[model samples]
Target: MPLQTVLVTGANRGLGLEFVRQYREAGWHVIATSRPLDEGVRARDCGAELLQLDVRDEGAIHALAHALEGRKIDLLINNAGYHPGAHQLGELDYSSWQTAFHINVIAPLQIAEAFLPVIPPGGKIVNIGSRQGSMACNREGGRYLYRATKAALHSITRSLAIDLTKRGIIVVALHPGWVKTDMGTDSADIEVEESVSGMREVIADLGQHNTGHLINYDGAVIPW
Candidate 1:
């Protein structure tokens, strides 16, 4: 049997890097993507094919899709994200917000759509989301841009799940816990390995039955 292939975006560090490492260790072929400046020596060392991809670049995405045309990708993880720092109640940079949405929401959807031809039936699409995106779970509010973008991502994930179900594609959103990374900060609760491991377990166990759900790394369903 051929090794399953997984393509992960933003795989230079943090959860994306860990996902690349774990999936490679599991005997899967991993295609790791990150921004042009991001040196992914770690990913290459893990035996992954490193692709320089700024998820926000439409032409680059299409180029990648064209380059890898007809290749069967078992999993596609949209893991690139941007958080323009903590925004106070009145202090919000509209420009940064737009960039955030472009990177966090629109890019993922576009990537998924562009890669559809390569993602065969039974392939999985995992969009990295956050509990901050949940309306039902939001009690304290700030960082409106990040929250809104992630919420949009969650909504898009649900729509993708519905649209792709007939094609046997499983689309789901996963909230990797607050991990200790550049985005998560050193004070964050979990390590990259722990969060990635839990998410890998969730991805491994996912099927048609698990499609369209917002799930935590530990396999718990989150309120949408």
Candidate 2:
């Protein structure tokens, strides 16, 4: 059997890096992208092909698609994201909010569009979303920038799932649990390994029956 290939964005560290590590260990072909070329050394050490990619750069995204034009991507994990720090109502940073929208919401959709030709039928595109994006799950009221962008990303995921149905491509947004990464902080709920493993399991089980939903790492469906 031919090895399956997975392309991961923001793979320099954290959950993205863990995905590259685990997939490579599972004997899959992993193409890992990071903003800085040098930061992908760890992924390269894990036997992944490293690519420098700033998800916000449209030209770079297209160039990457062109470079890997004929290669079949069994899975594409849109893991690049940005989280503007906690801000009070009056202290909100509009600039960071726009940046977050570009990285967290728009970049994923653009990347998916650029790579559409490489992803064959039955392929999967997993957008890394957050539980904070859930309108029904919002108890606290901070992180406006991050929360808003993730919500928009979830919307995009649903729309992509519907639009790509004819082509037999599966698209879903996954919340990787509160993990012990730089973004998640040390006091988070789970380790990066556990979150990535759970998400991988969910991705493996995705099909037409469950293509357009926001799912948690543990396989529970999150309310939109």
Model number with the top lDDT: 2
Q: Each model's TM-score, in the order given?
A: 0.98, 0.98
Give the number of colliding residue pairs in candidate 2.
0
lDDT per residue for candidate 2 within 1-224, as digits (tens), equals 78999999999999999999999999999999999989899999999999999999999999999999889999999998888885668888887877899999989999999999999999999999999998989999887888899999999999999999999999999999999999999999999999999999999999999999999999999999
Error of 1 at 63 (Å): 0.3
The list of candidate 1 runs beyond 4 A from truth reads none
Instruction: Report the C-alpha displacement of residue 118, candidate 2, in angstroms.
Output: 0.4
Per-residue lDDT tens digits for candidate 1, residues 109-135, read 999999999999999999999998999
Clashes of each: 0, 0
The residue-level lDDT of candidate 1 at 222 comes to 96
